[model samples]
Target: MSVDFEAARLASGTPDELAKATEAAIATARGGIERFKKATGDAAELLDIFDEANAALGNLRELAGMIAKAHPDKAVRDAADEAEQELDKVATDISLDREVYEALAAIDVSGLDAATRHWVAKTLREFRRAGVDRDDATRARVRELQEELVGIGQDFDRNIRSDTRTATLPPSALAGLPDDYVRAHPPGEDGLVRVTTEYPDVIPFLTYATDAGAREQLWRLFQLRGHPDNIEVLDRLIERRHELATLLGYPSWAQYVTENKMIGSADAAGDFIDRIAAVAADRLRADLATLLERKRADDPAATAVDPWDNSFLQDRVKAERFAFDSQAMRPYFEYGRVKAGLMDLTERLFGVSFTRRQDAPVWHPDVEAYDVSRGGELIGRIFLDMHPRADKYNHAAMFTMVNGKAGVRIPECALLCNLPQPGDDPALLQHDEVSTFFHEFGHLVHHIFAGHTRWSGMGGISTEWDFVEAPSQLLEEWTLDAPTLATFAVHYKTGEPIPAQMVEKLRAAEEFGKGIFVRQQMFYAAVSLELYRRDPQTFDVAELKRELQARYAPFPEVPGTWFHLSFGHLDGYSAIYYTYMWSLVIAKDLFTVFKREGLLDEETAARYRDAVLAPGGSAPAAELVRKFLGRDYTFDAYQAWLNS
Candidate 1:
C-alpha cells in the first residue's frame, strides 16, 4: 500500500555501483562497435551490446528517481542527478557513432529475415537522427540540449504539482447539501471544511451536492491553481524549448516537435487543424444554439454560455432529451464488474488474459498488478491504479512504464484512473466513467500487444505521436454500443442484464451537446498551438486566450484565472493537442470497418490484432492503418460521424 523504500533501493542498486556499471557498459559498447566495424564480429552481437549501453543509461535515470525519493544524504542525491546527466550524454554520444550507424546501415537486408531486417532499418534511422551523420561538435551540442531539455521538463512538471492550494469552507457554508456529503466531511479545528483537488473530494461535491455556493467555490479553487506561479515556469520552458529547436536549426519549437510525428511538418499540422476547425465550427454553432435555448429555458436570464455552466447544462440537456441519466446507469456498471468485463473483452478479442501478479512492486496500495498472458504465454504486466488519491495524477489515463519486445520482457504499463471507488452501491458506474475505462484499456492493449521482436526503438508507445490516440478512441465506440454493453453491464446485486431500452436511450444521447464539448476541446488545442507557433515577445498570452476562447466558446474572461498556467498537458503535448481529432479521424474509419463486418467478429478482431496491435511501431503507422482498413484513411469518416 505504501511506497516500498527497500524495494526501490533494490531495483535501483547503489548509486556509485550504478555509475560504475554505466561506464562499464559504455566501454563494452565502444569495443563492440569497433569489432563490428572491423568485420570481426557479427552485427547482431554488436546490437545486443549497444542495447545494453542504453539500458545502463536508463538504469542511471531510474537511480536518480529512487535516490531523490529515498536517499537521505544530499551529497548522494546530487551525485545521482549528476550521474544521470553524464550517462545521458554518454548514451547520446554512442548513438552518434558513425561506425555504429554504418554497421547498422550496411546490414544486408536480403541476408536477414523479416524480423531482424525491420529492427536493423529502424535502429539505423534512429542512429542517423541522433547525429551519426553530423560531426562530433554537433553531436556534443545535441547531447547538451537533450540534458537541458530533460531538466527543464522536470522542473516544469514539479512546479505545477507543488504549487496548488486546497480551499476551506465553513460547515455553516456547506448548507443546502446532501446530509451524507456534509457528514462525510466535518469541520476541522479551524472551523472550516477542507477539500483537495483529489477526485473523491472534488467530484462528489460537484455532482451531487445541492449547495451552489460550495460548488462554485470548489470550481474556482480548482480552476485557479498553478496559474500565476506557473506562468513563469511555462514561459521559461517555452524559452528553453525554442532555444533547443534553434540549436537543431529549426525555425521554431513547433517545427522541431512535429518532425518525428505522423504529420511530418508543422505546416501540415496547421493545415489539418484549419480543415477540421472549419468543419467543426459549423457543427459547434448548431450545438451552441441548442445549449443556449436550454440554458434560457432553465434560468430565463441566461445569455451566453460560461465555462462553469457548460458541464451542468450539457448534463441537463442530455437528461431532458433521452430521459436517460448517466448516473442511473451506474448501478449496473460497478467498478469491479466493469474491470472484469474489460479483461474479458481484451482476452476474447486480443487473446490476452490478465492474471494478478502479487509479487510485483507497485506505486500505490490501491494499485493491482497483473501479468497479461495469451494462451499461457506471458505478454506483459500492468499495474491498475483505479481510485482517487491525493497527489496522484488526476483523470483516467494510462502510462507506459515499459513497452513490449519479442524474446525480451513485454512492456509494463499503468492504467491510472479517477473512477469512483467501492461505495454503498458496488455496481454503480456513470456511463461516461465506463467509456473512460474502455478508452484507457485501449491504450493498455496497444502498449502490450506489440509483437515487436526486432526494433526496440520504435515499439508500442514509441510510434508517431499524432497516430497514438487511434486505438484508444476506437475502443470508446465499443462502450457506447448496446450489444457491447449487454456483454458486461449487469446489476451488481442481482446480476441481471441492463435493459436494451436503457442502452438505446444512452446511445441516442451520445451526440447531444457534442458541439459544446467539441468546442471546449478545440479551444484547449487551439490555444496550445498558438502558444508555440507565435513569438512570445509580441504575444500576450492572456489576450491570446481571450481570442481563442471567443473563436470557439465565447465567454467573458475570468480575471486572475490563468487557464494555460494550470494546464499539465501543455508541458507534454504543446502543439500536439490537435492529435485528438486527427487520431479520431483514423479511429472512426477503423470502427466503420468493424461495423461493416461485425463488431465482435473473430476474423476482424484477429486481423486487427495481427495487422495493427501486434506490429506496434515495428511497421510504419500509415502502412499499419492501410493493412487493417484495406484502404487509405481520410477525414471523411470523421466528418460523416459528426454530421450524423
Candidate 2:
C-alpha cells in the first residue's frame, strides 16, 4: 500500500498523466463508498470502511501539493487544480451521504476498545455537523453549500498564492540587508532591487532596511495583497459559514468551530480572550510608550510608532542595549547541522531513532525522507521539504500523506517550510527561524508518536484544533534553552559552538518586545472572534481592524491598507486564531514537567509520549492533559513565564 510519490510527481508534471491519476483516485473512492454502504455491524468490517474511506482520498492531498507548490508548468498546474476539484466532489458526496452515515452509525460498539468507540462517537458528531441528521431537503442544501464553500475557499487560497505583488527599490534602500541576499536578487534594466512579498525577501528587508520609506512600502504592499477583490470572496465566505452554522443549530461559525475544541464553546473562548487582554492592558500601554519614545529619538518629529517601524526599532534596541545581532547568529545555524542535531535530540529524548532513506520517492529534489524507528521497529516515515520554491506553500505545516491505523499501516507525514534556501554556504537560519523549525518538527514528532490508534480517524495530531499547537509550542521552548542550543549551534565555517553568552543575549532579546507581541496576538484573537460573531452583511473588515488595533494593540494601522485581505488565517483557521495564544498556556504548563527533570529527560518524554501524544483524539484533550500533569492543567505556568 506504499504510495509511489516519485511516480505521482512525474505523473503530475503533465496534464494527461494528472487526469489519469485523478480518475484512478475517483475510482478508488467509489469502491470505498460501496464498501462503506455495504458494511455489516461487525467491528472488523466497520474498520475496513474507515480505512478504505481514508485511503481513497489520499490522491487529493497529493494533487493539492502539486497545485500549491511548483509543477514547473502552468498547464499542468491548472490540470492539477481541476483534478483536485473532481476528487473533492467525490469525497464530499461520500461525506454528505446519510446512507453511509447511517451504516457507520448502526455498527454496535458495545465491546469495542476505547479508540474504536471514540471514532464512532466522532463520526456521529461529524455526521451531525455535516447535516446528516437534517431533513432530506435541508440535507441536500447543506451538501450544496459544502461543495460551494470548497470551491470558494480554494479560489481564496489560489488568489493569495498567485499574487505576485512586488516593489522595485534602488540599491540604497537595501543597505543594511546581507550582501549575499542583495547580490542574489539582481536589479533589472532600471537597476532597482526586486523585493517581493515572499518571506525570504520581505521579512529580512523589514528587519534590516535602513530606509523607513522602503520598509513601509514593502509592508503596505504585502498587507494590501488579495485586496479590493479578495474582500468580495471573504464576504461570501463569512456569510456562507454563518448560514451553514445556523442550519446546523449553532449560533455562529465561531461556536461551530469551538464546540468540539478543548475550549468547549465560543463563549468560553471569548471569555478567555477577554481575561487575557485585560491582564495585558497595563503592560501594553507601557510597551507602547517605550516604543514611541524610541521612535522620536530616531525621527525627532515622530509622534507615534508606525507598525512597520516596530521591527527596525526593536533590532536597533537589541544591537544597542543587549549587543545581540540576530543576523550574526545565522552562521551558527547551518541547515545540515540543525537537521542532524534535531534528529539526534529526538532519538535521545523520545527513545526513537531515524534512518535516512536517500532512495525514498519525493515530490521535489530539495526534499529528503527519513524512516523513524523505535526499538528496531519501524514506527513512521517523515519527508522534510524545508526550502521555499517559486509557487510553493507559503507557510510551514505538516500534512499527513498517509494515516496510520493500529497494527495495519505506518503513518507518513511531510513537513513543508520556507526556511532559508542555500546561497553560498548552507542555508543559515536566524535564532527565531531555528525555533520555528523546531516548532514544526515538533508537530511531526507528535504525529509519529501519536499514530498508535485503532482508527484512521483518531491518528496523529488529530486532537482538538485548539490543543494542536500545544505540542509544537512546547518544543519551541527548547530552542531558547542554553543547554539545548549547545547541542546544535555550531558555526558553519569555524565549527565552533555558539558562545553561551550569545545564547543568553538571544534569549534576552526574545523578551525585548514581549508586551508589544502579546498585545498584537490579543488583537488578532479578538479580531477573529468579532469577525465571526458579528453579521458579515453589515461588517466593515477594515474598520474592525482599526477598532481592534486601537483597543488591543499598541500601534495603530496606517491609512488605506487592508491587512485582512492577505490574512490567510481568516480562511484556514477561521475563528480559531486564538488557539495560537491559548495553546501556549497549555504548552508552558506542559514544559514545567520537562524543566523539573531536564530538557532531555527520557523518562518524562516517554511518559509524555504515552500520556499525551500517543492518545491523539482517542481521549478528550482535557483528560489527556490532566493525566500527564497529575493535576488539572492551569494558568500558573503561563503567568510565571510572563512574569519571568
Candidate 3:
C-alpha cells in the first residue's frame, strides 16, 4: 500500500498523544512475538507482528515530522523530535529481543531448507554483536547512540553536498579541452571557465585533453576543494568515529570494523594488507619505471610525474600500446546490452532471470525496474538508475532497500550508476564501466537470491565491510575475459565483435601503469590509516599526505591540496580503507578458482552461489570461503595472483 501523506497527517495526534500510541503499538507488536514463542502462533503470524511493528515505527516517525512541521513553536518541535526518538527506541528494543531475534533469524532462507538454519545462527550472532543481551540501561544507551550516529552521518554527507566552491579561470585556460567540457563550465560573461568540484566536467577535462596547462588547472581545482573549512569537517568526523568506537567498547574503530569482517580481527586484516602490499610493491615499482620511461620519452624536460599527468599519460600509453582506447570501446557497450549481458551471466551462474516492468516507481526518468525470478517463481526486484543528472551521486552503487526474512517477503535493491547519456553521440561504456556494472550486479544477485529466509539485518550487504566487496569484486573479473567480452562488446556502427587483435592489445596494456595505480591505492590507504591512527588534534593532514606520496607516489605531493577533506570514505571507512585491497586479494584468488574450473563452469558457479553469495552473512566469511575453495584463504594464493 502506498503511504498517504495527507491521511497520515490527519491521523497523527499531538506529540504526547502520538508518543503514547506509538509505544502501545510497539508493545502490541512485541506481545505478538511473545505469543509466537509461546506456540500460540506460527512463523507467518509472527512475521505479521514484525511488519506491524515496522509500520508503527514508520507511522510514528512520519507523524513526528508532520507535527514538527505543523507547529510554530520551537518547544513543540523539540517535543515532537523527542517523540520520534522514543518511537525509534521502542522499535529497536523490540527487534533486540533475544528469543524473538533468534526465532525468525533464518526461518525460510532462499527457498532452500538448509538456509533457514544458517540464517538463524547468523541472526543470533548479529543480536549478540548489537548488544541484545545487554542490561536495560546499556540497551537504552545503544538506542541513543544509534540515533546520534544516524544524524552525524547524514550531517557529514549534507556538508559535502552543500559545500561547493568555484575556481574561476580565463577562457584561454579552457583551450584544448573538448567543446562540451568547455561549454559545461559556467562562463562569466567576461569569458572564464568557472570550475566547481563536480565530476562530469572535471574528469573528462583531466583525462583526454591535449592541453597540459588546462588539465593541470582543472586538476588543482578538483583536488584543492578539500581545503580550509573542509579540514575541520574531516577532523570532526574522525573525532566522532573515535568517540563512537570507544563508547562501543572497541579500542579503535578499526577493531570494530574488522571484528565483523572475514579477517575476524584487526591484526588479521593488517596481515592481509601487508601480505598483498609486499607482493604488489615490487611489481608496482617496475610498472612505475615503465611509466616514467615513457614520460621521459615524451618530454626530456618532464622532470617529475604529477597526479594530473598520471591519467593523461596513462590513457596516452594505453592508446599507443593497445590500439584500443576505452572511449572507442564505449560505443559498443550500450547500457542496454551491458545490462542484458549481466542478466545472462546471472542466469548462467545462478539460474535467475530479469524482466523489465513498465509500472514501477523510479526516482529518475532514466531509472528502470526489473522483476527477478527463478523458474517462474517471483524472487525479488531490482531498480537501475544509469544516467548522470545534476546533483545525482556520481559513483555506481547498489543500495539494498529490503532484506529477506523467514516466513516473510524477499528483498529488493537499487543499482545506481552515473553512465553517459545517449544523446547527439551514441552512449558507450568504457571497460571499467562495464566492470562496474557487473560488480554492482553481483551485489543485486546476492541480495535478490536470498529469497525469504534470514534475519533482515544479516541478509545481503549487511556482511563484514571487508568481505562485502568480495561478490562484486569477483564479478569484475568476468569483464576482462575474452569469451565474456564477446557476449556483449559489439561495435555500435558496424555490429562487429571486438577484434582479437584489439583484445590482445587490451590485455597487453593492462599492466601499463601497474606501479602508479597500485601505489596510489597504497598511498590512499596509508593516508587514511595515518588520519585515524593519530589523535585528531595532532594531525597535520597535509604533512601526512606528503609523507605518504613521497613513499608511494613517485610524484612530489603538492602543497595546499587537502584532497582527503572530500573523501566520503573517511566518514564510513575510517581505518578500513585497507579493506578494499584486502578484499581484492580475495577477489583475485577467487577468480583463480573460476579460471581453474573453466570460466563459465556451472558446477563451480553453483558451488559459489550456494556457499558464498546466497548465504549472505549467515556463515563467517572465512569459513564460507574456505568451504567453497576446499582450502584455507592463504596469503600465498593472493601473492601468487599479484606476482603473476
Candidate with more favorable, higher lDDT: 1 or 2:
2
Best by lDDT: 2
* Candidate 1 local lDDT, residue 387: 78
lDDT of each candidate versus the true structure: 0.69, 0.80, 0.65
Task: State, as a TM-score between 0 and 1, how close model 2 is to the true structure.
Answer: 0.94
Question: Least lDDT summed over 10 consecutive residues: which range in candidate 3?
Answer: 1-10
lDDT of 2 by residue, 345-444 (tens): 8899889999888877566788888888899988888888888777666767887656666786677778888888886647777677788889999999
Error of 1 at 7 (Å): 9.9
Residue lDDT tens for model 1, 160-248: 55554676887765564445446667888988888666655666556544455666777777777676667777887777667656666
Instruction: Give the candidates in order of lDDT, highest first.
Output: 2, 1, 3
What lDDT, from 0 to 1, does candidate 2 have? 0.80
Candidate 3: clashing pairs of residues: 108-453, 109-453, 330-428
Query: Each prediction's TM-score against the native?
Result: 0.87, 0.94, 0.81
By the lDDT metric, which is better: model 1 or model 3? 1
The clash tally of candidate 1 reads 6
